[model samples]
Target: MADVKKVATRQSYGEALVELGAEHDDFVVLDADLAAATQTGKFKAAYPDRFFDAGIAESNMVGIAAGIATTGRVAFASTFAMFAAGRAFEQVRNSIGYPHLNVKIGATHAGISVGEDGATHQCNEDIALMRTIPGMTVIVPCDDVEAKAAVRAAYEMEGPVYMRFGRLAVPVVNDADSFEFEIGKGILMREGADVTIVACGLMVQASLEAAEALAAKGISAEVIDMHTIKPLDEDIILESAKKTGRVLTVEEHSVIGGLGDAVCAVLAEKNPVPVKKLGVNDVFGESGPAVDLLHKYGLDAEGVERAVEELLA
Candidate 1:
């Protein structure tokens, strides 16, 4: 056990926005009426003048963010994943992606881990939706440390970015000061020869735990945090798949058009291998505890271990 502290990525996003605001005067934030839930309220409190509450109109908010970006400001639009990536998708695609504006979509409450909010609130297709845009960059940070780093990187990186965040309080897997975050680069957490587990968002911690359990059963599992979903790390996936001979992708999103499909696409072209994907499996989430939903949907540590065992069998 790493004695890791737990924190929601949304909390880290708010804190990071405040820090980035201090560092860059051109940084501006926009929210579509869910500031507190999205944790953009913290940024609004610190820099009230720089924050814009678009009042429930997600499409308008995204358009406003794009307009701000044209004025040479880095606009961070915060809202729930469903609304930001779903309700306002057209605006995001045309206003932000089409123009290639420097707008960061802070999409929180993503995946089945969104808990009691249920299917309407949970978004399992944001990555699939965002990655379709030509110049859009999709990032799903594993923990608070990575979320903060991802926010800073999104600000620095030009063009539109959709960074997914979950509501569940996940274990902090990386040291804040020590971990280095780079766009489109994958981090190989555990090295093994038997199999490889590639994951993103909260599943990274679960995959790490599953790796530890697999180790006890004489099943050596390599764990890689494929944090940047878009621009999938082909080299790392190819290298690991070549060494391990098998790959298992775990995510909180749908099995279709997400991390699993992304990794399989890379492997199918470069180094084809037997791969199994664990995710929501084309179902809508219901109201329940976040942890319970994870277990029910097979996105938890135990579920991952079972998937790996089956893959090796």
Candidate 2:
């Protein structure tokens, strides 16, 4: 596991923004004094004229991004997940979402992986909160390749977008040369028959590892990377559930409004199946190492393997 090359999705986001900035000049970036943390600093440095630091006020940053978007320019507002999704919910929902503006929110340091930042910075409910707003496209990239692709896809699309990037350096799962990304689509990481493991963000790599572990245990566990939460790819989920008969959702965020609930909602209406959730169980995160937090909160590969085993039992 340690041998695999790892890169934080936030870092990928920054590099992707810089690439986009070089290609286009109609887009602008706004940060809530968290350019370095959110990885928008790369874009800021490359395109200083297009980048605007809105100080530490996340809400004000959203308002400014919305205003900029109204002027027919694509606005990418960046901040920690806690501030971008939680603190600026009202402004985002009212000013951007209500009007359906072309604004992309780059939310970094999401979930328990925020580590030493503790519960205050670890945003477990950001996905749930963002899911509530109408026409909000929520995306959680799994690896560096996926994260970079997601950023570019969000920029090409219209309306408001909420993208979550992790602070922890995760394993590179996808082959960069062949990988393709699309909004509201889920990627099949592994094919199996006994059970299905649906995941997003860093959890996708964990789920893939868990699937391999399950394979050794004589359990065929399929792995699906549900990168886009809102407008979820229900077709892929239903197909997997119909084939496996059991579905398990894994995420680094809360078990509440994250990937689990989104999958459950789809299955409940279209294809009902026995489902299990592996994530932070409505609890707060503490200051610790990023890897330790994932293990402690049961968001690691071992935890995912255990969940799959229990689900099949």
Candidate 3:
């Protein structure tokens, strides 16, 4: 077996978009004046004419992308997660979600991974915002391979989609040949009966590490990469909860209205368990290193292990 290389989800989006643009002329790339920073510049370099820079006007950019989608184009609008979901939220809701446009919103720099850029740039609520919109497909890929697959999947699926990515380089859990990607399906990384750790985005890496740490201490922790937030994998979650009798959700977003809440809503309605959530506990982030911010907000692997211990206790 060959050693698998780990790639960041942001890089995956950049590489995948270029390939998609090359294959389909209908696939257009739009950026809100931050193409270079968001990594969409890769696509711009390949397909210059098909790329549109909206010059800081995220709202108008989303509207333009939605309009383009209506004209039989798969518009992929790229910007910071905060601006994409927070600034142009209304435009996305009305123009994209309302009309059910085939628009792919690739929002990068999500979570505190923006590091020294501070809270204003970090989007901890992007998932919650996108999930609330009607007819919106929300996804957070666990690694670079998954992110590329997600981009391809988003282009094929019809409807408004928001794909969130972070700024940091995370460990690649899944490789291109490891498994196939499916929308609304949960990937079970490790199986156990003591507890289930359902995580997304950067937290998926943390959760997997925590699961390994827990196993060293005689606790069997099942880890699930619940990448898709909207149209969540309910069956997998319910089954995990029923088998483990305990569940802990970890995310880079806030504990409220994010992946944790989404999992809780499903488990509560079906099979309720001792569910604990590890994330930003209702607070904004500060200017610092990405790993420091994660620790400060109690979202690191140690934090996840602590949450799992508490749930088991």
Candidate 4:
């Protein structure tokens, strides 16, 4: 196997948009002035006529996307996670979610991995916000490969979708040929019986590393990449929980309303088990290097391993 390249999921989203633009003429893109930063500039370059820069008005940008969707077009609105999910939330809820339009919100720079941008830029509640919207689909891709696949999936699916990516680069975890990207399905990256680690976005990589470390310590840890947040793959989660008897959910976002809560909600109803969540503990992030912040927040491989060890202990 070739060494996986490290690239930001946002970069993959941009490349995927260009490819999607070439494939579907009805696929239009809109960015709220942060084109280069959000990676929507690539789409603008590829399909200038189909792309629209909606200035800094994220609310208006989402409204414009909703309007465009009415014309039978799949509009992908791109912007920073903070503005897209927080600032323009009302517009997204009323204009887009209310109508159940075919609008895909490409929210990049999500979670603490945004780095150095401080708490304002780091969106820890995007998943929670999007999940609240009725009939809305939410996805947080693990790496560049999964991000591209998710972009394509969002375009193909109907109704409203919120796809989140981070500014920091993560290693590609999936192979193009073998990996099958499904909208609401969870991918079992590594199988084990002692415990299962369910993770999304950047945390999936850390979970995988933790699984390997655990295995060396004679602890068989299963790893599941739960890319999709809403309409979560309940079957896989329950199956894993039943098999392992213990579960751990990890994410780059807050442990409050992210993958952890979602997993617990299912397990609590279906099959009760001990579930530990590894993520930001309802605290705001500060300016620091991306990797440093991840480590400090206990979201890295070592952090995950320690969490798992303590959970099992």
Tens digit of lDDT per residue, candidate 3, span 1-313?
Answer: 0154556678788889998887898889999888877889999999999999999899999999988998998999999999999999999999999989999999999998889999899888889999999989999998888898999999999888999987888777776686798899999989999999999987888888888899999999999999899889999999989999999999999888999999999989999888898888889988999888888888888999999998888
Question: TM-scores of all models?
Answer: 0.99, 0.99, 0.97, 0.98
Give lDDT tens digits, candidate 2, residues 132-157. Answer: 99999999999999999999999999
lDDT of 4 by residue, 1-313 (tens): 1276899999999999998888889889999999999888998888899989999899999999999999998999999999999999999999999989999999999999899999999999999889999999999999888999999999998899999999998988888787789999999999999999999998898998988889999999999999999989999999999999999999998888889999999999999999999999999999999999999999999999999998899
TM-score of 4: 0.98
List clashing residue pairs in candidate 2.
Answer: none
Best by lDDT: 1
lDDT of 2 at 72: 99
What value of lDDT does candidate 1 attain over all alpha carbons?
0.94
Q: How many residue pairs clash in all the candidates, one count each?
A: 0, 0, 0, 0
Clashes of 4: 0
Model 3 poorest 10 in a row by lDDT:
1-10
C-alpha root-mean-square deviation, each candidate? 0.9, 0.7, 1.8, 1.2
**Stretches > 4 Å off in candidate 4:** 1-3
Return the lDDT, model 4, position 82: 98
Deviation (Å) of 23 in candidate 3: 1.8
Model 4 RMSD vs true structure: 1.2
How do all the candidates rank in terms of TM-score, highest first? 2, 1, 4, 3
lDDT of 1 by residue, 274-310 (tens): 9999998998999999998899889999999999999
